[model samples]
Target: MIVRIMGEGQVTLDDTSVIELNTLDDELLATIQADDEEGFRRTLGALLDGVRRMGTPLPDDTLEPSELILPASDATLDEVKQMLSDDGLIPG
Candidate 1:
């Protein structure tokens, strides 16, 4: 799955679903700026859960050619962590 933050308060999902959460986004940024790690995580989780409830991914067979992709290459745990830390999402 791929997640992209389009702007301060908008999140675009695979170029299909565009969601606007201005209030939530502001709160998240505030928490992040204040170094409230738990608050940041909770808000992020809620945003993620909202998208998941929308059924972003239909099914494997329903995806278009551009949406389909191979799995990530095998890597050590630390390597994967570093990769994720460097980029929020892996390239498709």
Candidate 2:
């Protein structure tokens, strides 16, 4: 799957990486529901970092559509909250 980090370019992630991302997404949802800004920040940073570490960076010239769009590392809880869907950012 192709994941896009807002303000960053796209990265290609395999199925295993997608599963990992889904787990992080769940944690993020929990933090949002709990209204824990610190947890949200930490989890969001981890999620973005995981993507950066596990995903293969796509070339800028690539035009493929992204399957998921994630918030930036510095994204505020409110900003990320607005981006969440019923299935979260990355659907299982």
Instruction: Report the number of the highest-TM-score candidate.
Output: 2
lDDT of 1 by residue, 17-88 (tens): 323533454565566556676776676566545545543554444424332121122323344334435662
Q: What is the lDDT of residue 62 in candidate 1?
A: 43
Q: Name model 2 segments beyond 4 Å from true.
A: 85-92
Error of 2 at 37 (Å): 0.3
Q: Which stretches of candidate 1 lie over 4 Å from their true place?
A: 1-20, 58-92
Root-mean-square deviation (CA) per prediction: 9.2, 2.2
**Cα lDDT, model 2, residue 83:** 66
Task: Tell me the deviation in Å of residue 36 in model 1.
Answer: 0.7
Structural RMSD, model 2: 2.2
